[model samples]
Target: MAALRDAVGRYGIWSAELHTVSPGERGEAAARLEALGYGAVWFGGSPGVEDAAPLVEGATGITVATGILSIWQHTPAEAGARFLELEAAHPGRFLLGIGASHAKLAAQYERPYSAMVEYLDGLDAAGVPASRVVLAALGPKMLRLSRDRAGGAHPYLVTPEHTAEARGILGEAPLLAPDLKVVLETDPGLARSAAREHFARYLELPNYTNNFLRIGFTEDDIAGGGSDRLVDAVYAWGDDARVRDRIDAFLAAGADHVALQIVRGGTPTGLPADEWRRLAAVLGL
Candidate 1:
């Protein structure tokens, strides 16, 4: 846990477009993130560990995580081999974040809990230590597994209240890192619009909807691209002070760290570099 904490501090970025960034520019972006003092960079969109090694090699003194690499896509042997290779080149600077992604996203997705258990077993056999991995867990069963087997849990699209409930379940052992969506705009209408644009696609996913239900969002709240209350609860929107307050609330709710995914006004792939800098200043990091 100490090593994990040292690698990913209190805040980081979970970007879907990071891997898509041009190779030449990706390293520069990573370097800029390090200079801005973000503790970690999470490459989402189900990247393989191989896709992340170049980013690790590109930057210094910052943790690089998968946000989650889907179990169905990468075999445990391949993942473990890549982990070792990356670790050899950059020790204590890479975190393996694995998940049982949505059913619709993978053709072989079935018995996810069992599959994740088996996957972890294979990783163990392949020499990837439990401390080097984190599970993208949402339910109690997976969260317990995260504590018992992996370094911790990395839950996505969660609220502060969910953070508190997850902490209670984890009981202070495993690391609890949740993804928090943020819209930098101060205007309520514009912020919610941005949030909806980022969230509408997710509403169709049962895994996320089920988790939202567990966290107390009603079916109505989940419908129509999510209700205002739902969006407000899930996103940290507004100016720097308001966003910082939201981050503080999550921390106070027992989050070990929060990985913020900034939802910019236009394309989510636009890369909100300026907003990242603003958040760094607010977080004093």
Candidate 2:
């Protein structure tokens, strides 16, 4: 667990668009992220181990991880084999993040917990060590599994309060890296709007809404593209200082690392390299 935390460091970048580009472009961007001083680069959008391989190859020092590879998409044998290949090539630089995903997205997403256990079992049979893997866990049960089975939990759409609870369950050892959305805009209206635009889709997912409800957000807070309070709590917006403060809150609440996902208005595609640079400056990465 200490090795995992040190490998990922205190901060990392999570991007859905990073996986949409060509292999050469992706590699170059990954190298730039390492140059910018980010500890890890998480390949978002349900990426496979193969998707993160180029990032591991491109960045010599930065840890490259799957924000989450859905268990339904790839067999554990296939994932484990690919993981081993990347490990042999890059050694400690690769971390495998796996998840059950949402029922809406996966046609076979029934009995998620049991299925996750089975997937981990298969990975074990395929010789993928639990220490090299992390689980995209949300609730207590899965969080417990993350502590007992994998190296840690990589929770998405979570708050610092959730981080505190997860850390309690993990007992100060397993990595607790949560994905945090950031909008660099300063205007309250603009920042909340951008956050709502990015958060709209997630609100439709029951898994997220359920988690939100569990974490104390009311139905009204979840309605109409989320309330301002909900938006502010879940996203780090306003200015550099505010962003840093929100990220620090997570650390204070007991997160090993925070994975920042930049949310820009208009279309949520293309790499936000400038934003990443600005964030690196603000974070003193």
Candidate 3:
């Protein structure tokens, strides 16, 4: 866990867009991110284990991880085998972040806790070390599972308050890295609009909405593309200082690392290298 924490540092970049690009482009972008001093690059959007190959092959120093690979999509044997292959090549540069995923998104989603335990058993049988794996845990039960069975938890769409509660459940040993959305825009309307555009789909997933409710957000707060309070709490918008402070809040609340996913107003895809550079400067990375 200490090694994983050291490799990930305090800040990392998370992008679903990386999966859309060609392998070579992804590799180049990963190398650039390493150059920019990000400790890790998380491949989002339900990527497969092999999806991280190009990133692992490209960046010599930056840690590469699946921000989460759905357990329902890939069998444990396959995921464990692919993880071994990548580990053999890149050694310590790859981390397997797996999740039960959302019920609406996964047809096979049932008894998720049991399924995750079974999946871990299979991974264990297939020679995947528990220390190299992280769970996309949101609820208390799943968070506890992550603490006892895996290296740590990589929670998505969470607030600092949630982070603090998760940390209490996970204790002090396991890694607690949460995904945080960053909107570079300064205008309240523009920032919230972009945040809503990115966050709308997540509202439909009970897993996330339930977690929001658990963390003190009401149904009204989640309705209509999320209330301003909900948007502001979950996303870091406005000036560089404000963004930096928000990210720091997560760390202060017991998050070992914060995976920043930049949200732009126009298109949802693209590398957003310029925005990343600006963030790197502001973060003094």
Candidate 4:
């Protein structure tokens, strides 16, 4: 827990990438990113915790994490093996971010929380140290479970406010790391356009929609992409200083680490290499 806490204190700027760098180039990209000073990389999209190793190899020492791996789609044995392998390769630089994926979407979502607990129990029984992992939590129920069962929660698609709420729920100890979306372009309308278009898919997912509604977004705000207010709040855009300011907002609100996702293309929020370099420069890491 102390190591996890130390990680949070040190990993001030983490970069999030939905599209993984191809194997041929991933390692190189990661090395460059590490050389650039980004402390960690948050990866997503269903490869389970197994994805950590290859990407970790990409960067010499930067921490590589699954933004989340649905606990339903894989077993603890497999994840445990991969977890150990990566840990052997990089030690403290690999963090496994796991989740009880939404019941509406996961292949096996029965007793979601309980299933996750069971999964964790198996991991423990199989010898996967709990400190090496985190839960993708949002609401209080999961947040509390995250505190008790594993290291902490890695909440996605949330604002600084949610980080504050999660911090309160998890209390003073569990790590509270939240991901924030960003569009580096100076154009508000364009950045919001990219954000809204990219966010429409998640809006239909009841869990995220429900969370947004609870967070004060109107039905209109959730409809047809997203309202300007919703887009601006969720996606930190404008200048380097502005985005850094938003990161500060999350930190002040109690987030230990903020994963910054750069939205480059409208279709998949592509993060161009040059763009990543630019951000890395401004972040001073």
Candidate 5:
């Protein structure tokens, strides 16, 4: 099948934590996200290669992607079999996202680039197409490797500045999808707190910390949950307009697609109507 490279609005589920939303809720969330004017559903987390079909089972036109499936957890052979099966059944709707997840977390995360390439070869051996996959790349080496190996790159917790750097490294035609967080509240404390809860877990991860440190963030800035400056730079908190401006920043920076992670209460909304309406208008679906 062909790649789903169409310009999907920069808003969808980061779903980096797919298990957070159950199988039943996955489809429901996809429909609601599309209804809310979001273009794609980027399902994430450590779901085994074959574990995500139910996540996008209910949606039709929307593209379902794994922001990242760990290569360590499931062999490429396994992922390929499942991916090909799903693509045959649903053609042009599934984008397989693979990642050399954090090294510390993997049993033996040595040689991430090599591991990822071998995994891709495994998928090739199993009949999965190169155009049907994406990589979770932060640095330039991985970015180049991604272009050579998969369809493009899907970066998480990255700023528009990072997006620009990535775009430069990737050049034209490679898909560049970045995930952005949004807080619709006007209260500073609440918004910051939300950013903290969602981001603190990532602070200790070497992949994230090292990437930020290389980007010029000070050690102080990399402190727990990220300093306010770091949080504000990475998370687009505040009113709808402010968040929209950040989205514009990313697009202007040359990102092909942006997956907006509406970080708020329970569901995507669970906040207020005005914020939703304003965002929908800005997104243009």
Candidate 6:
């Protein structure tokens, strides 16, 4: 956890569209994030580790992690090779975050727990140290595996309360970094609307909903694009102060680091540089 926290500081960016941005633009943004004192930049959209190499090269110090590279998409041997290549080039600047992903999203999804174990075994045989990898876990079994095998857990679309519960499961040592969605809007309606827009897709996925249910949300709370209460609980919205409070809450709840997925205005595309800059000032990062 110490190494994971050092690699990714108190806060970092989690943007799925980061890899889709133009190479020059991505490089500039990566460098800017490093300059802004962000500890890491999480590449999402189920990226292959190779996809993140350019961004890792663009930034000199900041850690570059795959928010999650789907296990179904890349075999452990392939992922291990990529990890070695990147580590050789950048040393400790990369973290390979892997997950079983959602059953609905992967055709080959089956016995996720066993599959992850097998994948880790492959990685182990290929010489990828456990310290260099993290798991995208949401439940007790997976979280336990995260503690026993990997460096820690990186749960997505979760709240501070969930962070606390996860901390209990992970104990005090494993890295407990969760992806938090944020909306930088002052108006309640606008903020919730933005949150709902971004959250609607996840609502259809049972993996996320089951996790939400495990954390106490009812089926109704998961219905109709999520309730206002659900939206508020899941997303940190409003001004910088409001967002800061939410970030602080997660840290207080025992999260080692918070990977913020900034939802500026309503769109979740391109680089939200201005929002990131504002958040940096607010967080004093």
Per-prediction CA RMSD (Å): 1.1, 0.8, 0.8, 2.2, 2.9, 1.1
How do the predictions measure up, each by TM-score? 0.97, 0.99, 0.99, 0.92, 0.90, 0.97
Residue-level lDDT tens digits of model 3 in 1-285: 799999998899999999779999889988999999999999999999888899989879999999899999999999999999999988999999999998899988899999999999999999999999999999999999999999999999999999999999999999999999999988999999999998989999999999999889999998999999999999999998999999999999999999999988877666899999999998998
The worst-scoring run of ten residues by lDDT in candidate 4 lies at 9-18
Candidate 4: clashing pairs of residues: 27-58, 36-285, 37-285
Model 5: pairs clashing at backbone N, Cα or C within 3 Å: 10-258, 11-260, 12-260
What are the per-residue Cα lDDT tens digits for candidate 4 across 32-137?
Answer: 7677777677776656665556667766667777878788778898888878887887778888889876767786668777888888998898788887789999
Please, what are the lDDT tens digits per residue for candidate 2 over residues 117-228?
Answer: 9999999999999998999999999999999999999999999999999999999889999999999999999999889999999999999999999999999999999999
Clashes of each: 0, 0, 0, 3, 3, 0
Overlapping backbone residue pairs in candidate 1 total 0
Off-target runs (Cα >4 Å) in candidate 1 are none
Question: Scored by CA lDDT, what does every candidate get?
Answer: 0.89, 0.93, 0.93, 0.77, 0.78, 0.89
User: For candidate 3, what is the lDDT?
Assistant: 0.93
How high is the lDDT of residue 56 in model 6?
A: 90
Best by lDDT: 3
Per-residue lDDT of 65 in model 6? 90
Runs of candidate 3 exceeding 4 Å displacement: none
Pitting candidate 5 against candidate 6, the one with the higher lDDT is: 6
Task: Provide the global lDDT of candidate 5 against the true structure.
Answer: 0.78
> Total backbone clashes of model 6?
0
* lDDT tens digits by residue: candidate 5, 1-285: 124567354565565545665677667666666677766777666666455686557777677888788998888877888988888888777888889998777897889988887898898899888877889999989999877877888998898889999989888878888888878777889899888887877897988988898887989998866898999889887766787788889989988888876676433432233454566776665
lDDT of 1 at 46: 96
